[model samples]
Target: MTTLLGCDFSSAPSRRKAIVHAVGHVDRGRVVLQRQDRFESLDDWAAWLADDAHLPWVGGFDLPFGLPRELVEHLGWPTSWVDCIRHYASLSRQDIRDAFAAFCHQRPIGGKFAHRATDGPAGSSPSMKWVNPPVAFMLHAGVPRLLGAGAEFPGLATGDPRRIALEAYPGLLARSVLGATSYKSDEVRRQTADRLIARRTLIHALENGDPPLMRDAGLRLRLTHSQRDALADDASGDSLDAVLCLIQAAWAWQLHERGDEHWGLPAFDPLEGWILGA
Candidate 1:
């Protein structure tokens, strides 16, 4: 079986805000959690992924794999995935900020951000946004490693076939389970009882395969009592998000096994890649 992984990334990871990865697979209609690992630095995570033993794995990573096509076109960057990413990698953080700032400045106040086509369905922040979530920096920090690792991104780069990466948004999965209820907060003061309850509800939904996405595929999550508690108690939701991505990765891998073209993705713009389960 292909090793399945889900990654919750941090653009500027540190000991306090590490990247979380869930590693395991789906077996007998159940998504099993073998382990969850933490990496305080992207370099360390990259090195871990580069190990030969880690090949033949497919991962759903919570990071933007493509920029907004509108922004790329306005900047006159290459429209091809590899070329566009190469060009984006060459830019400094300050350079990216200036360019994105200029783009926002030219737009109307309420429409300051340029969004990718997938943003609507995925309900993700604009990939060009430089602050708050800082996903722009995530692409800057994460995509290069994926490229260098030769991970194949469907509809993007067909790199090392054994190592596949799909752009994923955990919010999409969580929202399906909890609707608009918020289940995570970085601020300790904001990690209220309501959020904790919501996390438990979300976990219950996953275990039952209540969502149509899971129900249709006959998939239910299997977690130990301790593992479930750990995911629910993580106020930042990084651990839960990693598991969500892992489920998404498993769905895509299942589709691939069934010989589905594009690995279950809809008709997508190659320059603006689609999220795996969106």
Candidate 2:
């Protein structure tokens, strides 16, 4: 079976540190077992994320799929940016660039374009950008790759929505464990120690059956002995990050199973599209 996947992402190479890890979903309650893949270059990463042969696993990637409604509408390409998005999906990379550029050229300063919060959570740049966070660059870098890879956009398309790709909020996962303590560690040396502790904390919480994490959620896990040990053993919550993606996947499944309309956006996003947690 194609299991769900969670990824701990980094735009930079990891010669000194692990760059990205695709944590695979295994037994009961995702005991992060195998590292699915890794990348030292964005080109290689983009190429991997775009491949269709590896999907149908409902990958909860740490990337933004849509721009803000405010930004899209402000640019005036299509009042119904959603519909425009559908059409935009069919365009080539160059075409998307030209159109998005035109949109920016028409807009004012301090507001080149708006971005999704997932951008920050995933460490990606604005979807409308071509530089800086280059999230616009990432979208340019990533989405077309998703399309090329034949990854389904459940929000936009109908077939194999099972290849489900959604914008995940890692903050949702981090907050559950750290509770707004600012667990993000960018200092290089501090990253390993911080990750190790976070993993320990989450394991402890999971063991005690923490309500927010274990009780209220509807999903269930069926972990093997090795799987369970692996989770606690991994110093970096790379496994946890993947499992966090899995939990978000479960949350998405729960909302969808609830018969949410408008692609589960109302429950997931009231102002934005289906945000995790609040």
Candidate 3:
């Protein structure tokens, strides 16, 4: 009953901002993808996540769980990273935004700030401070809930570490599938074709019984012919992002159950906490 979940997250808190994609794995290694259910708001997503006892899921979130230590120190806040995040949660989002902006404003234009350890390892920007990608906001918006929901923050360890939540980049899998091809587009016509291509590629990979997926995953998208036709009608991969997350989650589930815990590897900042996943 172990299932893997993925979130193609947004910083905003509307139903449109939260989409949950899950893949279920039975006793043996099988991949069963769940439907993409968009929530009405962040609270709805929280409500769903809070039901931790129901579904046996281990999730790989797309947002950063910790901030750069340097960033923490700059704010003259507690040296502990998790403490800083929990503190910010008590403040308004606007206040957090203003503080980060001021921090950045004081820095030199180029190489203005330090980044979270996850960012360097994942090739993503810091998820605690907004600048280019605004991944920082995503962390601000996302992590506290995971913690609140009792999802294991391996590094933080304030919640149930067994709830296992890792940080995964869907791009890693998409790159392997499409190989530098811009198969995921935002334009309607282009995105539609890319999605169809992605779907077929995934299906083909599944039928062949890929290593990550055994031949027994009792879950699927169950896309209708018309749904397939409709998915093809758009060029952006917002939908594709969810599907990609499903696949990524499946991959991570395989490792999480088997991988050795370093208590946080490579970028182990005792304060920020450890990074989990394969």
The clash numbers for all candidates, in the given order, read 0, 14, 8
Q: Looking at model 2, which ten-residue stretch has the lowest summed lDDT? A: 263-272
What is the per-residue lDDT of model 3 for residues 1-278, given as tens digits with 9 covering 90 to 100?
66666677776755434554544443344455545566656677778788856466767666777777887787887776567768867777787778778888888888666776655544455556575567777777787887788876555555565466666666555554455566555345564655667656654554355423232332234344554444444345555555555555665555455673532234467655433322
Question: What is every candidate's alpha-carbon RMSD to the true fold?
Answer: 0.8, 5.7, 4.5
Top of the candidates by lDDT: 1
Best by TM-score: 1
lDDT of 1 by residue, 1-278 (tens): 78999999998889989999999998988999999999999899898778879779999999999998999999999999999999999999999999999989999989999999999988999999899989999999999998988889998889888999998889999998888999999999999999999999999999999977788888899999999999999998999999999999888888888898687799889998999778
TM-score of 2: 0.64
Clashing pairs in 3: 32-219, 127-136, 155-273, 155-274, 188-235, 191-235, 192-234, 192-235
Per-residue lDDT of 168 in model 3: 63
Show the lowest summed lDDT stretch of 10 residues, model 3: 211-220
Q: How would the candidate models be sorted by TM-score, starting from the highest?
A: 1, 3, 2
Candidate 2 Cα outliers beyond 4 Å, as residue runs: 11-23, 26-34, 42-55, 78-135, 192-195, 206-214, 218-239, 254-272
Better TM-score candidate (1, 3) = 1
What TM-score does each of the candidates earn?
0.98, 0.64, 0.76
